[model samples]
Target: MAHLYRRRKQYWIVYYLNGNRVQESLRTDNERIAKDKKKKLEYELALGDLHQSSKLPLPMILEAFCKYMLRIRTAKSYKNEVSRLGYFLARSVTLSSLCRQGADEQRTMLHL
Candidate 1:
């Protein structure tokens, strides 16, 4: 379940996901719009359609990808891919950071 509240003249929604409380701004001051967004969020949550991958840490996602690769990829190929991706893990790169920084900035950061 999600509940809507007003803070600093803007509406926000709070809900629990997997026992963790998540709060997000509705980005609107209008009560009706806030209500609509809250309803939409609840519907998405109920259907499990919300894509939270952008908020996931990079290393966790990389680990999952490596596991999937291991199933179909040769050991050598998997090792090479993992080593390439390990740089991001070592630096604690995150999905959100990459999205915010844009592709060019990321390439520069990686010195590629």
Candidate 2:
């Protein structure tokens, strides 16, 4: 379950995910708006679709992916993927940045 609280003038929502306590600002001081947003967040969390991926940096995500790949992929395949994705890591890419780009721009950026 999620709970709402006020901190100074802004309202915040606190919830748990994976046994971790996560808190996010609602960015509104109004109780009604905060309550509505809390409900939306709870619904999203219930559906298991509330991804925090966009907030993660490319290098961090790449590192986690590499760890997973190492467990199931051949060394050569893992190496190849790491090398390929290294380009994005070097450029400090984030999921939100890619999402903001146009389709053509994304294709060009991905060299596709």
Candidate 3:
């Protein structure tokens, strides 16, 4: 259950999840807004999908996937994917470049 409390002007929330206590600020003073957020959080927690964690790097994820693929079965496309991912990692580029390139393509499409 999500508990909503007030700390001066900002509303704070606390809940016990997976034997760990999670406390987060609602960043709002309004009771209605805080209640709505508390309800949403409670619903999400019930469904076991409230992931409050950082993501692993793309190269690390790809490396783990390659290892898993090797353990399961071999495929030509999978091998190619591993090779391509390795080349990208060896180049030591941040993944934001890929995001920027996709955004640029979308901008061009919009301009057309």
Q: Model 2 — which ten-residue stretch has the worst lDDT?
A: 94-103
lDDT of 1 by residue, 1-112 (tens): 9999899999999998777788899999999999999989999999988755477875455556755765677656754565566564674654333334243543454444
lDDT of 1: 0.69
- For residues 1-112, could you state the per-residue lDDT of candidate 3 as single tens digits? 8899999999999998778888999999999999999999999999998976545876565545655654565455544554576576785643223234343443353342
RMSD values for the candidates in order, in angstroms, are 9.7, 10.7, 11.3
Candidate 2, lDDT over the whole model: 0.70
Q: What is the lDDT of residue 68 in candidate 2?
A: 71
lDDT of each: 0.69, 0.70, 0.68
Of the pair 1 and 3, which is ahead by TM-score?
A: 1
How many clashing residue pairs appear in each of the predictions shown?
Answer: 0, 0, 0
How many collisions between residues are there in candidate 3?
Answer: 0
Task: Give me candidate 3's TM-score against the actual structure.
Answer: 0.48
In model 3, which regions exceed 4 Å deviation? 55-112
* Candidate 1 runs further than 4 Å off: 53-112
Residue 96, model 3: lDDT of 29
Q: Give model 1's TM-score versus the native structure.
A: 0.49
| Candidate with better TM-score, 2 vs 3 | 2
Worst 10 residues of 1 by lDDT: 94-103
